[model samples]
Target: MSTPTLPCPGCPGRRNHGQYLCRTCWRSLPADTRGRLTRRDKRAVLRLQQLQQALAARTPLQIIRVSP
Candidate 1:
């Protein structure tokens, strides 16, 4: 006897769909891996880190316009 389960949102994981992703899908996520990033994932992470560093190094820009 087992409880009813639903199809995973990300993939067809045969588990309960209480969350957005099932356990299998969650485990398969690239971000969840430990020190084993693929080349593409690593590049993406590095790019994001660079963007964050650049943002932190500069002041935010603001624009104001008035019309009469």
Candidate 2:
């Protein structure tokens, strides 16, 4: 099974625990998160995309396994 998403800006943090953060970054989020996306975070997201694209570029596109 996969981890649930961290809390989103969808509602208040006190209501639901962090079930809206992207699964990969769940550990980075706080239990009581600040909903606003800060400037550094925006830049970091761009950097994350660049890092993802860089990693993805070297991999073959075709898949070998199927999920049920």
Candidate 3:
């Protein structure tokens, strides 16, 4: 079985199911931001919200930051 892919919220690329961003966009995110987003704690949802807000505001991926 293969994972279903959908359009990435961050860019025009496609991302696999259960992933937040496509490979290109994911790799473009800062290491700290990626780490925070990958964490599955209570604050994980908040971190995802922060990422979405940044993307909506057209913030650059390199400088995007989420609360840790």
Global lDDT scores for all candidate models: 0.40, 0.33, 0.92
Best candidate according to TM-score:
3
| lDDT by residue for model 3 (1-68), tens | 45647999889878898899988999999999999999999999999999999999999999999999
Estimated TM-score for each candidate? 0.31, 0.26, 0.92
Clashes (N, CA, C under 3 Å) per candidate: 0, 8, 0
**Candidate with better TM-score, 1 vs 3:** 3
> How much is 18 displaced in model 3, in angstroms?
0.4
Judged by TM-score relative to the true structure, which candidate is superior, 1 or 2? 1
Which structure among the candidates has the greatest lDDT?
3
Residue pairs in collision within model 3: none
lDDT of 2 at 36: 24
* lDDT tens per residue, model 2, 1-68: 55434453322232224233343343343322212222245455554343345334642212111111
For candidate 2, what is the TM-score?
0.26
